[model samples]
Structure formats: structure tokens, C-alpha cells
Target: LFICIDHVGLAVPDLDEAVKFHTEVLGWRELHREVNEEQGVAEAMMGTGDQLAENARIQLIAPLNEDSTIAKFLAKNGQGIQQMAYRVADLDHVSAVLRERGMRLLYPEARRGTSGSRINFVHPKDARGVLLELVELPKEAEEH
Candidate 1:
């Protein structure tokens, strides 16, 4: 089951510039930053209010390699929103149900995500043209 929107992912041509704009222009504070070699992305999470709160942030994703998915997205669509991530209470169960209902998952198996969560994406075509990411945070990270 879905809990709430975790963050909206924006594919950016340059991570530093994006982060600067969000922080200086929009007044959002950078909460976290990481480079995932496997995913071929360098991302920074920006939040306006409480950094620890769920659904209060945006993730700026920049390609770490030219051949990465973000790079392809930028080439096709330019820098913009790439995906909407939703936090789920039970990722495995949700994934199973989606499969049973004939939905296409980008990563069929759950993979490590930012903040140590298990995550997978529902293909854009299967999700009505919106790339949707499903994230299941660790028990301790859940909002009370």
C-alpha cells in the first residue's frame, strides 16, 4: 500500500547548478547528496521545511555517465521532472499486486535507493506516461 509521495525526481543537466538554484533561488535547503555508481547518477535531495519529514522534498538527479538513463532522458526531453516517487508500507507486497494486475515494473526486483530504502520503478507506459518510483523505507525511518 502507498503511504505518501516521497519526493519528485528532477533530471538535471548539472547537479550543482540545480542544487544552487533550489537553495538560493527557491530557498530550499539541501538535505542529502549521494552518488550511486550502479545507478549512474549523482543526486541531491532538497527540502523546504523539515528535512526529516516525508513528502517534503525534491530530488535533483544528474547523470554520472553519458550512457545513463538520466542522460538519455535529458537528450530526449531536456532537464525536467523525471519521476514521482511514492513511499510504500510494503514494497514487496505492492510489487506483487502490481505484477498480478499486469503492470510493468522497471526493475522487477527491489534495489537499494537513497536513504537506504528499497525501491523500484513502474514503467512510464504502464503508469499512464508517468514514471513512478515506489520506495519502501526502513521501519525506523517511517513517520510515527
Candidate 2:
């Protein structure tokens, strides 16, 4: 159903500060960064050693506005671990299987995610109170 743990997402009040702390203090290297307006968040993918390795990711996500989900999560739980992402070979297939198994996904269809990956979320309520993100990397990236 899943390849590996893709990344662990951390909700932060400030993206720059989070990235700086992770990079400078934690000795992580910044791998990728992007802003997804539709998701209303700014994110950075941090890593060490081989950037593309499955074990090398820690995503830092910051709300773009007060209305963003990250903002709401921060308001309720404070800045912390927001989600655990799993890599999938086929998002649509995995989504269908999870649906058949009675897991509720947040999106009816896969949505655009960091680094051109197709992604969807398993509802926190259905995922044992943990937000779970499913990601299918782009074809070119799959070979890496």
C-alpha cells in the first residue's frame, strides 16, 4: 500500500525560522521549498546525506494566512508534529484500496503536493487522530 514513510510534517509559526533552526541547529540541509496557495501554506523539505533517501525528510509547514489549516492547528494544538506522510507507487490505486477498507480520505481526488507529487490525506478522525498524507512522486522523481 505504501513504499515508505515519505516525510514527517511539522507545523511551525514561521517557515524561515523553522528552516533556519532545522538547518543550522539541527544540522539538517534544506532540500526543497515551495508555497502552495491552494493549500494556503508555505513549506520546506529538509534532509541530510542523500536528499532523496526515504529517511531524509522533515517537512516544515507554515500557514500562509489565518484561515489556513496550519494556522487553525497551531491555534488548537500549538506548533508541533502535524502529519506523517507515506510514499505510494500509485496514489489512485492506494486511495481506492483505503476507501474500500473504510478509511476516510480528506480529498475526493488527489491534489498537487510538493515537488510535483500527487497527494491526498487520510482524515485524522479515521487515522487514529493522526493526520496521514499519501504521496505519489512524479515519474522522473521515481527513478531517483
lDDT by residue (tens digit), candidate 2, 31-142: 8899999899999999876648644799999999999999999999999999999999999999999999999999999999999999999999999999999999999986
Give the per-residue lDDT of model 1 (tens digit) for 6-122: 999999999999999999998988988999887899999898776367338899999999999999999999999999999898899999999889889888589999978899989
Q: After the best TM-score superposition of candidate 1, give how far the Cα of residue 121 lies from its true spot, in angstroms.
A: 0.6
Winner by lDDT:
2
Candidate 2, clashing residue pairs?
none
Leading candidate by TM-score:
2
- Go through the candidates in order and give the clash count of each: 0, 0
Every model: Cα RMSD to truth: 1.4, 1.0
Q: After superposition, how far is residue 68 of candidate 2 from its true place, in Å?
A: 0.4
List ranges where model 1 is wrong by over 4 Å. none
How big is the RMSD of model 1? 1.4
